[model samples]
Target: MQNEKIINYIKNWLDNYLVKTNLNGFVVGVSGGIDSAVTSTLCAMTKQKVLCVEMPIHQDISQVTRAQQHIAWLKSNYNNVSSVEVDLTPTFDAFKQGLPKTNSKREDLALGNSRARLRMTTLYYLAGLHNYLVVGTGNKVEDFGVGFYTKYGDGGVDLSPIADLMKSEVYSLAQTLNIIDVIQNAEPTDGLFGDSRSDEDQLGASYDELEWAMQYEGNPEELSSRQAEVLKIYKSLNSANQHKMKPIPICSIPSEFK
Candidate 1:
């Protein structure tokens, strides 16, 4: 891809969207990941008011450090960029405490998703406070290929600037944007579970394999065992998570009944 052309295009798109919506600016949740780094840089390039909020809920120290470093770099480079760190650890703890005890095996997964929802709530709160749009950091693989993000959580946003870019494309933009090495080099993780589990660990496949599967429309018989396994993983996730990829379902009432 022509990196410079894509970068300029996104910046101009953001500027025009802001004018059309008449919103003050954008508020992005920086997560010490490539997608967020590239996205925040693009927003900053627009020279618009961009608020980078870091909401950590018992997050790994490395992730938090990278997030702070990226935000610091952004401020130094762009005068329009600003940042805030909201420690949601206490809030998350209290929320869990208030909830009833559960023996379901899905409890851990549910709480992991809750962390993302809490951050989403925090981002929207900031956006509302400043009349800014909540900018999403999801990429093509996560947003469309496998639906890896949390629905109504990190998935909740006013606009997604990088959703069309693949993970590799996101990295290309990160390098051009001069994102901090620590972030660009760090393993991709959602940081929702307060642990060091990487995205690949959770997804059962690396982003490169998933990306290939997303675009693959070939004879399955020619594939190796590993490749076939990856394809199955990709297809299973794509089928199961269609709920996230599609618009919300609404039951239509019959006009005659009304």
Candidate 2:
């Protein structure tokens, strides 16, 4: 129940995974928010060589400043850490230049997804070059319950150490670790679009209420109308985005079983 215990548990679990898999290190994308900051710190504390990448795409100064702070915090708080910043604005534009003229909706969505894929691709390249597994920053409330993350974007990673923790729990752990304010208080953002939308705002209910409805509930029919609405949004996103979480199916694997 304690935050320190949870972090220790995660650290030990990661140590075991690294030993079994024989990975030399990890690479994580830090977004200047509490989740990424805390996740990176944990990795650094585990005696892993961590490469923290800041891939900002047309972001404002505030976001960039927080990112620098994250890097500084990582240096002062822990060793065996290196930082890199690559602006993705040009990359996003180049990809868009080749696309056919469609409605703004398609263009925008495509552009956003492309940025995510680009970040993952770059991370993978770095992973291969440096022999480090990509450490994901998604938390339990984001990935499991409602599927709030971008497919192939933030969701593409080899492992997510904090995937099982709720948002509140993540913050609690950050406090225990004494993660700085720039990280702990940074307004949560996807850092893709110009405006940042809170994850819960996109979802129908608050994390606490949603967790309660999902964790301890009877039949859906027995729930109140409000509860049903929350369940509907959660299930809708989950079903629609389920494909993103799974690997591409190999349709060419011979038809013997069928």
Candidate 3:
């Protein structure tokens, strides 16, 4: 399908969703990545209220700059677009200070996830005030293949517009939408670590490799060594993060108890 057709399809889908939900519009948490840029742009194309919020907690300067530029571009192109920057550094610091100090090795990962959850809270708070839905920016590989997103953190959203698109497809859409080059060319990152760690750095395999693994139906014995390793990594992550992909499990009581 043509990129423009896909763009219009997503815009129409967003419009229909807004009509059904009777919500005001969309509020996207812009992270200076291609996914967010494309997602926010698609929301903007619907000509509805789009609040692109940049919630940064000790974020790298490049990421922050690209987010600002993308938001500026959106506002300039679409009058319905608006933006806000919420510095959550102090809030995160306070939250950390309140918690008991821990020397566990998992603390780093825990704190990284804490950042995502904090941003999720901020997005929902804005969404509540404006009666807008929180638009998620996760792509197919992260959302369903390897499940690389943080549970209830980046994973928390009222709606996800691009979860069906692969990372490469997202890049294609970004190019079609004329997303700012700084963002389009920048490496994909969750930005939860408060540093310059790329998504590949965290996942050990690139999105292309993960996408290949996600759709691979060939025999494992026929695969190359690197492909086998990538498949292993993908499966490990997908299995470990099934809790994020699946619905919340509900334990049912025996009928005799009632």
Off by over 4 Å in 3: none
Q: How much is 125 displaced in model 1, in angstroms?
A: 0.8
Model 1 per-residue lDDT at 9? 96
**Which residue pairs does candidate 3 place in steric collision?**
none
State each candidate's clash count: 0, 0, 0
lDDT of each: 0.95, 0.80, 0.93
The per-residue C-alpha lDDT of model 2 at residue 227 equals 83
Over 4 Å off, model 2: 219-226, 246-258
Candidate 2, residues 59-147: lDDT per residue as tens digits?
76787788788888888877889988878788877887877878775666667677888889888888898988899998887788767
Residue 89 lDDT, candidate 1, scale 0-100? 95
Error of 1 at 170 (Å): 0.4
Candidate with best lDDT: 1
Expressed as tens digits, the lDDT of each residue in 138-189 for candidate 1 is 9999999999999999999988989999999999988888899999899999
Candidate number that wins on lDDT, 1 or 2: 1
Predicted structure 3, TM vs. truth: 0.98
Worst lDDT run of 10 residues, candidate 1, spans 171-180
